[model samples]
Target: MLDLRDHFFVPDAPAVELRAFTHGLMPKTVPAMMERFVEDWRERGVDAWNEVPNHWRPGSGEVVGWWTLPETLGDAFIAPLLGAPAGTCIMQPNVHWTVQCLLSAPEPFTAGRNEIVFSEGAFPSVQHSVYQWAAMQGLRPRPLPLGADGFVHVDAVLDAISDRTAWVFLSHVGFTTGEKLPDAALHAVAEKAHRHDALFCIDGYHATGSVAVDVEALGADVYVGGLLKEACGSTGNSYLYVRDGLTLTPRLSGWFADADPFGFQKQPQPHPDVRRRFLAGTTAIASLYHAVEGLRLLLDAGLENVRTDSLAKTALAIEQAEAAGLTLQSPREAERRGAMVILAVKDAAALCEWLKTQGVFTDSRQNRVLRLAPFVWNTTADIERTFAVLEDGLKTNAHQHVVAPASAGPVT
Candidate 1:
C-alpha cells in the first residue's frame, strides 16, 4: 500500500494498521480543533455550543453548535469557498438533497414553467433526478453535450438558453477526463443565464478542495461539494452554498428549515431569511463534526499553498508520464487543469492491473485514460515511484506487443 501517513494522521504503515478501517480512524487532534471552533462560534455571539430546545436537537454527543450536520459544517467549510465572507448562507448536503429541497417549495417556490439546463457529464443522479422532477412538473430539462476533450462548449450552452430557462447547472470539473472548465468562461455563461433570469448552479464536488475556489468571485448562485474527495473525509454528507438574499422555498420541506419547527401550527410560518431556510431536517452530527475538523486543517494550510503544491505535483506527474511515452489526456496548460493528471494509453485495463501489482494506485476511465491524483498528502517521492512503476509496465507491455503483433490486436 502507498505511504499515506503524511496525508492521514496514522503514524503506522497503512498495511499493518488493523485497529480499524481507514475511515474509522479520527484525526488525533480533532477534539482540540473542534473546541477552538466552538470558542470561535461563541465569540461571534451565535452560542452554537449551548443546548437549545428539544426540537432544535440535531443529535447526541458533544454538540458542535446545534448539531454538526451539513448545514453547520457547511457554514464552517464555506469560509474557504466564499473567501470567509460574513453573513453568507452555506447549505451543506448532497446534490440530491439540494434537488429535494428545491422541489419541495410552496407557492412562491413553484416550479411552474421553469427550465434547468445541465451538461450530460455531470453527476448522473443529480442530472437525471432534476430532469425527471422537472418533466413531471411540465418543465423542460435541457441536456448539452460536452466536447470529446470533456469540456462543455460554452457557446453551445449559451445557445441552449431561452426566455424560460430558470437555472443552468454544470460541474466545474469533468469527472471522466479530469478536465477543468475555465472558471471565467463558465462565469460568463452564468452571466448570460442571469440575463435571461436563470440561476447558475455548479457542482463543485471535483473542483472544491482539489482546486482553489471563491463562490463569490465566480458569481455562481449555488455551489455543491462533499468532503470525501477534496477535504478527505467520509462520504454521503456534502455542502451547498446559496448566495445571500437569494430565497427559494425548499421542495423537501423538513423540520430544520421551518421558521419555527417547534411551533405546533398546522402550516409552517414564513421561512427564515437566513441560510437555515435551505436546510431540511436534522444535520448529520458525526460527519459534520469530523468534516469541520477536516476543513480547519485545509484552511490552516491555506488554499493558495494547496493550489501551488497541487500544480507542482501535477506538472511533475505529467512530465514523467510523457517521458514514459504516455499520451497526455488532460490539458497541458496548468491554468486550464485541475489537480488530476490523466494519461491516454492503448491497453488501459492491462496497464491498470500491472500498476496495481506494482503497488501503484490509479483510476482508469472508460475510454483509455489513466488518472493520477496526488493530493496534499502525496509527496514528490510518491509521484516518482508511481511513474517508475508506470514506465516498467509500459515497457513490459510494449515488449509483449512487439513479440506477438497478430495476437496483440489493435491498440484500444
Candidate 2:
C-alpha cells in the first residue's frame, strides 16, 4: 500500500517476495554504488584509506575515508535508525562478532558475577556465544524456557536476573516466532539488570528497519543488529550501539581497535573511542559502499512510516491466513508482532517449495512453521495472490507430491 516498490529492484518482476524476514529486495542504487567503489579503488588505490570522494555524503563537504567509514556511517545512518546519539554507535561485521566481542570483554564479568541470563528462544549467535563463554570463563549460562505460548515469558526472564547475573541477553524481535517484545518488557529487564550492576544487551537483527527503536527509552546498555535482512543491505553489514559512558575492553580485539596502529607499540592499548574498541580487524570496505543504500530509501521514507507499512501489510497477511483456515503461529496482536508472520502448516518445507513454484517466495523451519513477511515491495494484491496459491495448494495437497531437493543447501 505504501507503493515503494519503485525504489527496489524486485527480482524476476511479477513474483511476489514474501520473505523480507530473511532477505530484502536490493535497492535500485546498489549497482551505481558498486561502480563508485570500483572507481575509487581504481583511482585512489592505497591513498583511498586517507581520503576518497565522499560518495556516502556527497556535496555535503563531509570528509570520509575508508578508515573511518565504520564510524562515519554509524553516525549518519545507524544512529538515526536506533534513535541513538552520535559517537555511541559503530558498524561491526555481524551480530555474532558483536556477541563474541561482548563475551570476550572483561567488563561484564566483574566482582564474581558469572551468570548470563537469556531465553532459550534466543538466536544461536547469542545462545551459542553464552555457552561458549561458559566453557572458557567462570561463567554460567542461565537460559529461561519459552512460555507455553511459544513466546518469551517476560516475568520469568526478569525474575532470573540476580546478583550472579553478569549480562542479560534478549532479542528485540524473536526470530523463531516473529514476536516483538514490547518496550515496557525490555525496559523492565534493563532496569533489573542495572539494579544488579549487570549489562543488558539486545539482538535486534530483525527489527532494525521494520520497527521504530529508541535505545535510550529501552534502557539497553548494548544493542546489536544487522542491515542484511529488513534493512535490505547485503551481507557483512552489522552494527553495535554502546550506551554513552559504558566502557568495555575486549580480549579478542585486533590491532584495528588499537589506540595507536602506526605507533607499533610492543603492548596493545585500548582505543579512546569505546565504540571503536569493538572493531576486530581490517574493515571490509566493499560492503560499506552498498551498506546504507537500502537504508537511504527507508530513512527518506521515515522509519516510523516503514513500521506502519509493515504492520498494515502483516495485518493483511494475518487476515488472509485466517480466511484461508490456516493456523497462525505468530502473534495476532499488532503491538506484539514483528515484520514476519508464521503459519503452522503440515510439510511446511514442501509447502514453501510449492509456493516458490507459484512465484510466491516464503521459508519454513523444522518442517512445521512457514514464515513470510510482506514488506515495502509487496502489495495487498501480492498478499491476496499468495494466499490464493496457498489455499489451493493446501486443498489439493499438491505440496506433498513434490520431492525435496537432493542438496537444498542452506534454508536462508
Candidate 3:
C-alpha cells in the first residue's frame, strides 16, 4: 500500500529507473529549496552564510543543541540518518575530497604501519584516490582479494591487518557485486582495527541514505558518504564523520580550517580537533541546499521503511531475474545483498544501451553484470515492465546479449 513515486521527479511513466544504486532520482521539493537558495544569493548576497543561525562548530564532528536555518538544517537532519551523531558530521564537496582529507590527516598512521588496506571490489574512485595518496606518502597499498565468494569475510579482512596497517577502509556494500558488509562484520572489523591501532573507516556512498546506518553501532572511526548517488542531491555535496576523540591533523588545510577563518589573520594552526581540521576551502552551498530536501524526504518516509522496501524490491528482482533465466551475480539472500541486483550477461553494455532505448534505465559494470536498483519511487509494476522488456528482447534474439558463465567475477 505504501508508494512515494508521486513525491519524486519521476521520468515519464513506464520509464523505469532501477538505477538508484548508481545515482538517485530527485525529490519534487528540491527545486523550490534550490530556488530559495538562488534567491538568497541574489538578494541577501554574502549575508546568507551568516543568516543561518549558525550551529557551533565543535572541533569534533558532533552537533550541539537545536538551531533553525537553511545551511545547517541539512546536516542537523542528515547526520542521524547516516549513523553519525549531530555536529560530528561535516559536509564536504564530495567523497573524493573527504578521502583526500582523511589521507592527509597524519595522526592515525604510525611510522612503520602506514599502509592502507581495502579489497579490490572497492569503488574504483575510492581505491584509486587511496592509491595515489599511498604513492605520494611512500606508503604501501594493500589491496586484498575478494576471492571466489565475490565477497571478503570479516575475519579474513581483519586477519589481513598487521601492526604496519594504518587504515582499514572499504565500502559498506560492494559496489559492483552488491554484497553488503553487515553490522556483525562492521563491528568485528572496527574492534579488531582498533586493537591493531588502525583506524576503521567506511566509504558509505552505497549504504548511507539507501540503507540504515548507525555509526556508533558500527564502531567506525571515520565514515564518508555523498548525497549524489543515493540521497537525490546534486553533485559536489558529501560528508565526513569523525569519531569524537581521535585527533587527525589535516594537512589538507584551507581557509575553512583556519582558527579565525573570517578574521583574515591567516592563522597557521588548523583546529586541533577533528571537526574543523578537515574542512577545506569554501564549498558550493547551493548544492547542499538541493541535498537537504532529499534527506528530509527519506527521513519522512522512515529509514526502516526504506530498508524493508529495499529488501522486498531486491528479493523480487532476484526472483524475477532468476525466472528470466538470468544468473545473479549478487547474493540470493536479502541479508547478504544491498539494495541493487547484479546479473551476469554478456554484451552488458549493449544490453544496457538497448534497455535505455526502451525507457528502462540501468547501469552495467565489469563488462558483464547489469545493475538494476529499485528505490522509493519504484513500484512492482515498474520492475515488471522492465523485465518484461528483457524477456521480449531475448525472444527477439536480435542483437541480444548472451548470459555469461556463473564463475565470472567482477573485473574491478
Candidate 4:
C-alpha cells in the first residue's frame, strides 16, 4: 500500500488516531493555503471576489476567483472523488443545506407523487428533512426498518416503491452500523424508483474518499457528502452532484443562485447551470483554499489503494478484537464494510476515554458501540497497540471506573 503518512500532519507522534471516521488529521499544506487566503483578502479586499491568484491550480493557469471556487473546485477535485463528470457537481455548505434545498424544490414532488422512501439507518439529516417536509400537506415519509441482519432491507425498500413515491433516499453507507450497501442492491432500488417515476438520491457522506464511488453506476439522480471526515478537509466543505438533464429550482435558493444577481430584479430566476443553482449567498472562500488539499493527497495515492489499506488494517483490528473477546457490530466481510469498524462494548464512552489516555483515540456511539476507521495514515502496528490497550482495559475493568472529564464535550 502507498504510505502517505508523511503527506499528513498526523496527530502528536506516538498517539494513534483511530477516529478517521469522525474527523481526519489535518494536511500539512493547510497552513500555506490559509496564508494564501489571507494574502488574497488583504491585497484585493472586495475585489478578491472578482479575481484572485489561482492558488488551487497554480501551474495549470486556471482563472479561479473567490466567486467561482465552488464550481471550479467541484469540477477539478470533488468530481474525481465521486467518479462524476465535470458540470454535474458543485460545492455546498453542508449536507443539511443540500438536502433541504432538494426537499424544497417542487420538481421532485410533482405529478401527484407524494411519498419519500428511506431506511431508518439513514443519518439524521436525511430522516429529519423528510419528516420536516411532511408538513407541506401532501408528502408522506416511508421509513423502513433494517432487516434482521441489521442492514438495509433491500426487498422491503423495493416493495415500498410505488407510483405515489416521489423520491427515494438511501445512504451509500449506514451511518450507525458502518454497512456499505452493494452497488447491485442500489441499482435495483434505482431501477424501481425510475419505474415509479421517482428520483433516486444517495447520501455518500461516509463512503466518499474511502471507497471508489461511481454515481452513474449507482443511478443516483442526486448525491451529497462532505469532506470533514476521511477526506481530511475541515468543516464548511461539502458537495452535491446532480445528474445531467435534471432540473430543480430550489425554493430555498438565495441571491447567489439567481441567474442575474446584479440585476436586482423583483422576480427570482434560477441559474442556467444546474450545479450552480445549488449555491446560496456569498461563498466561503477561506474554506475552499484548504478543502482540496486532503483530496489531492487521496487522489494521488489512489482511492482503490486507500480502500485496500483500510480493509487490511481493519481486518487486523477485527482479528485482535476477537482474540480479546470483543463482539463485532460491523460487517465482517470487506465488501460490505465501509471505512469504519464498530465493536459492541459495554460503557463504550468510558472505554473510549480510557483509550484516549493511552494515546489511542476512538469514539463511541449511544454508549454501546465503539467506532474506528484505520486509514492510510495508520499502520497494522497501531491497530495492534490499540487492541493491546483495549484488551488490558477490559480485562481489568479499569475503564468502568474512570469518569468523563468535566471539560469533555458531548460528542465522543
Candidate 5:
C-alpha cells in the first residue's frame, strides 16, 4: 500500500522540482529566484528612483531585506485570492501585517465614522489585528458570532451595523468547519456597508486559490490572502487589494513608499499611485519570483480542475471517516466547503501520532479536530492510502498507551 506520508513529506530535492500537497510554507528555489528577479527588476528601472543598495549577497543571502522569500511568496499568492488587478498594492506580507496597516491609517472617524465589522469565530490573528487597529484609531470594533450551522450568521452581522460602522471584515471561508460564506449574502453585506458609507474587507486566506475567486465581481474595498494556505507557495507572504478608485491614507510608510525614492531631497513625498503608497520598504524579490512561478503553475493547471479534484478527495475522506464512525466537522454541503476537510475525533493528537507511524500524514487542530488538506498535487490513491492507515491506527488505539515505547533523550 502506498503511504500518504511519503507523498506529502518534504523532500530534500530543490523546491522547483518538489511536488507535495503541503501547508504551502516555503518552496525550494524561492530564495535564489527572488534575488535574481529583484536584480532584473532593478536593471529594468523598477527601483531606479530608490537607488537602494544591491543587498543581494552570495552564501549569506538571508539578510537581503526586511522581508524574506517565504514572505514574498506568501504575499504574491494572495493576488488571486483578493481578485485584485496585477498591480494592486500588498501591505505587509501576512494577514496580520495587512490588518495592522489598515488599522493604523490616518483616516478620520466621527459619530458617523466608518465602522469595521467581522464574524467572531474567524481567525483570531486577523480579528485581533483589526481590533487593535480600531483601538489605535479610537474606533470601536464589532464582532458578530457565527451560528450553530458553523457559518457566519449574516443576519447577525447586518443587524450589528450602526451609522458609525465604516467597514465590514470577514472570512470568505470558515476555518473551523471549512464552510464557505455565501457570495450573494456577503455582497449584500457589502452593499449595506456602502449604504452606511463604510468599506468592506475580507480575509480570503482560507478561500483564495482553493476556490474560484473574482475580486471585481465581489466588489469588496479590500481583500487579504496568504499564499501558504491555498496558493501552493511559501509562508511569510500575503496580499491585499484596495478596489481601483478607493482612496485611503496608508498608516505605515517606508522609503520604498516615497514617490521619488531616488530624490536626494531631505523631504520625502508619498507616491500618488495607489499601489505604491501602501507598499513599505523593499520587496522580497527571491520569494516573490518563485511565488509568481507557482501561481503560473496553478493557473496553467486550471483552478477548476484543482477544485474538482480537491472536492472529490475531500468527499472520499469524509466517506471513509464516517464509515469508521468518526464525527465529521466539515460542512456536508459541497457549496459550503473548501479543500480542507475536518474530522472530529477523540484523542486527535494521539491519532495523528499513530497515523504517522503507519505513514499517514495529517494535521490536528487545537480543538480535537483532525484536518486533512488535499491539494492539487494529491490524488484519489493518496486518500485511499490515508484511510487505510487511519483504519489500522484506530484498531490499535486501545493498546497504544502500553505498546508504544517512550523515546530516549537525544544525543548531546
Candidate 6:
C-alpha cells in the first residue's frame, strides 16, 4: 500500500490527516526551493530579481518572450495544467487583489454593463469582496440561490444572467460541499454570459490543484486561483488567467505594471499584452519560488494521478461515513465530487473537537457539516480511523448534535 502521509511533514504523523483542503501539508520540495531562493538572495542581492534564472522558454504559447523581459513571473507552470494559453496567466498576491484588478479593467463594466452575478456558495472572503465590489460599482450583486440539495444548479445560475450583467463569477468548486461544477455546466455558464456580453471568471482556489481543469474547454474568460490550499504552496502566489487577445487596461497601476518596467519611465504605458497594467509592485520572490516548486512537484507526480487518488480518498471518506451512519451533504457521483466530503450532523464543532482529541484532523462548516477532506497524504486506514472516532464521538451525550436525522442519503 502506497501511503502518501509519509511524504509530508505532518506534526502528528500516525494521526489521521484529513485537513489538506484547508492547509495542504507542505511537500519536501517547498523547503528545498525556499532554501535555494534564500541562497539566491544572499548571493545575488538586489540584482537577483532579474538575474535569478527564469524557467520559461521564449515563444512557448500564444505569446512568447516573457522570460526575456525585465520583470517576469514563472507561475506559468500552471497554465498548461489549467489549459490556459501562454502569456495569459499572471500570478498575483491574493484573490482580493486579483478580483479588484479584473473588475477595475477598463473594458469591463462599461456601456450599461453594471451587474455582477455569483452564487452564494462562493468562499466567504470572495463572496464578501464581490458584494463590496457591487456596492463600490453602485450596483447590487445578484447571487443565485443554493439548490434544494444545498448545491449549485447550473440551470438556475444561467437563468439569473441578464444583458445588464457585467461579470459572471463563481467558485470552480463549492467550498462548503466540495461539489465541482462539471465542464458542460461551466461551458453553459460561459456561453450564457457571452450571450449577455458579460465576462466569465472562475475562482479556482479550491479547484486548481485538486481538480483536473481545462479552461478552454470550460470556456472561462478569466480564471483566478492560488496555491495556498490544495496546491501545497504558501500564500503570496495567486494567479489570474485571462483568455488570449482580450484587452483590458488595468486601472490599478504601479511601476511594475509598466510596459518597460526597468526603464523608470514616469509616464506608465502598460504592457500591451495580458501582463499589461497588472502587477502590485515587487513580487515576493521567495513566495513565488515556493509556489512554482509546489506546482513542479504536482506536475512531476502528475495531476491526473493526484486527481485519481483524490477521488478515491473522497469516495472512501463517503463510504466510511455512510457505513458509520453519517449523512452525506456532498454529492455521491464520483464525477461531481471534489477532494472533500461534507457530512451533515447536528454538532459539527463537537465532532471536530472530539476528532482533534483523537489525533484526527477535520474542519466544520456552518456549525453542522463535518468537512472531511483526505488528500494524497492520507491512507484508507486514516479514513477508517476517522469514521471509528466519529462513531465513538457520536455515542457520547456531550458530543451529540441537536438531533441528527435518522440515517439519510445525500443532502437531496
Candidate 5, which segments miss by more than 4 Å at Cα? Answer: 1-22, 25-83, 89-91, 108-111, 264-268, 402-412
- Candidate-wise lDDT, in order: 0.63, 0.91, 0.76, 0.89, 0.64, 0.75
Whole-model alpha-carbon lDDT for candidate 5: 0.64
Question: Lowest summed-lDDT stretch of 10 residues in model 6?
Answer: 62-71
Give the local distance difference test score of model 6. Answer: 0.75
Tell how far residue 17 is off in model 1, in angstroms.
16
- Candidate 4 lDDT at 311 equals 82
Worst 10 residues of 4 by lDDT: 56-65
Model 5, position 67, has a per-residue lDDT of 30
Which ranges in model 1 have alpha carbons more than 4 Å from their true place?
A: 1-7, 10-64, 67-71, 103-113, 398-412
- Candidate 2 is scored at a TM of 0.98
Candidate 3 lDDT tens digits, 186-270: 8998988888899998988888677888888999998887777667776777777888787888788777677766577845677
Please report, as a residue range, the 10-residue window in candidate 2 with the lowest summed lDDT: 403-412
TM-score of 5: 0.80
Residue range 1-412, candidate 4, lDDT tens digits? 4567888998776789888878788999999999998998899899988898788786777566787789989999988998899999998999999998999889977778899999999998899888898876568999999999899999999999999998899999888989999999999999999998899999999997899899999899999999999999988999999998999988888888899999998998999998888888887778888898888889888888888888888888999999999999999998889999999999998999988888889999988999998888887778888899899999998898888778856677
Candidate 2 at residue 56, lDDT? Answer: 82
lDDT of 6 by residue, 71-149 (tens): 2442357676697767878767788887877777758677887888889898765677777767776865888888988
* Per-residue lDDT of 100 in model 4: 88
lDDT tens digits, residue span 111-188, model 5: 557466788877877788867776666677787777887677889988876678876888888777687777787788
